[model samples]
Target: MGQSSSTMSSPVIIPAAARHTATLIFLHGLGDTGHGWASAMAAIRPPYVKVICPTAESMSVTLNAGFVMPSWFDLISLDPNGPEDRAGIEKATNFVHGLIEEELKNGIEASRIAVGGFSQGGGLAIHAALQYPKSLAGIIGLSCWLPLHKDFPKEAKGNLTTRLFQAHGSADPVVPFHWGAETSALLKQFMENSEFKTYPGLSHSSGEQEMEDVKKFLQEVLPDN
Candidate 1:
């Protein structure tokens, strides 16, 4: 897979091998760089689909005892009902939107793009995709839960009919398995195309089966034309 870094914070881009018809913008988890998911995504994506893996900015995470690390937003607490960094989330969401806008400028329709991520990144993807003003091809989330879930269906004005694939391990410790199930349920309240899968013995990290599922989801949603 070809790789290039145009700027200090630029994403690790895997250009489409053939005519670019679709784009997948995948975000990395906390403390990880875009390079972490680059090769994996490239292996699964079709030649006509360009993969863009964007790294999160470095910031101090309260959950990590104020240690600086690459994170999409500040994790003030792990409590599902605890305080959230709304400002930080908004900033990151705007950044994701900017990436989508750039692809649109490059002639890729909003419907030809998919946004997804893992863990913290996955939460951000769900939040950003739901708030996006245009319809996206799909949304993928792995081992993730919605960050500010209270404002849903109402705040989620766009992509109501868009397809969503969310997966979580039954033994996930970081983000409880129930959170994923609840998120799927909440999303289903308005999004009829949502699907949630459970991994029997999986943990906080992804497995071979999960990746295969993601590959199929990508193929189904962003098929080559």
Candidate 2:
């Protein structure tokens, strides 16, 4: 899926049946493609919303038993001290920004777009939305960690009063619920009324409740038509 020498391919526009200008740009996780979690659409479907799902550049997924799969970067280790692929990170940032610009060009306001993802993709969405320099309609992360290791610049934080919906299973092994909680806290520390909910017994997979939460988030963030 490396259409360019970057960590993210261009957005694949999936038009909703209604001519809604709002967009949800979804990024998938490690070992997954854009289509991997496309089922999220059904959970999010409302009249007049378009969703863009982009595949990450394919890289050999070493942590997942060395199987080659689509991924944003190599997680040298789970430790903070581990090496990181800076190039991949930069490419991902650029690709996400490019998608936002293109969506605005297509007539959607910056405030009409939300970014959501699962796992590593979720991490990217958190980082990207925090730096997006304008208020988003919303941001959602499922089964992913917060990218607070990188600071969100002051200007973006000032403009980001947008709603946030984050759901993580309390018993998730890959991404602990605490991560989501901390991200929510951090967001509220800078913005207003960011929402975070944790499912008590759910796992890394998005439970039905979490998907329902996404609908609620969209209902709260999207403009009433």
Model 2 spans > 4 angstroms off: 1-3, 6-12, 61-67, 80-83, 153-159
Write the residue-wise lDDT of candidate 1 on 63-129 in tens digits: 9999988888889987888999998888788889999999999999999999999999999999999
lDDT of 2: 0.74
The best candidate in terms of lDDT:
1
Error of 2 at 183 (Å): 3.2
TM-score of each: 0.95, 0.86
Please give, for residues 139-180, the per-residue lDDT of candidate 2 as tens digits. Answer: 887877655344544535433676767778989888767776
List runs of model 1 lying over 4 Å from the truth: 1-8
Q: Give me the candidate number with maximum TM-score.
A: 1
Local distance difference test, each candidate: 0.90, 0.74
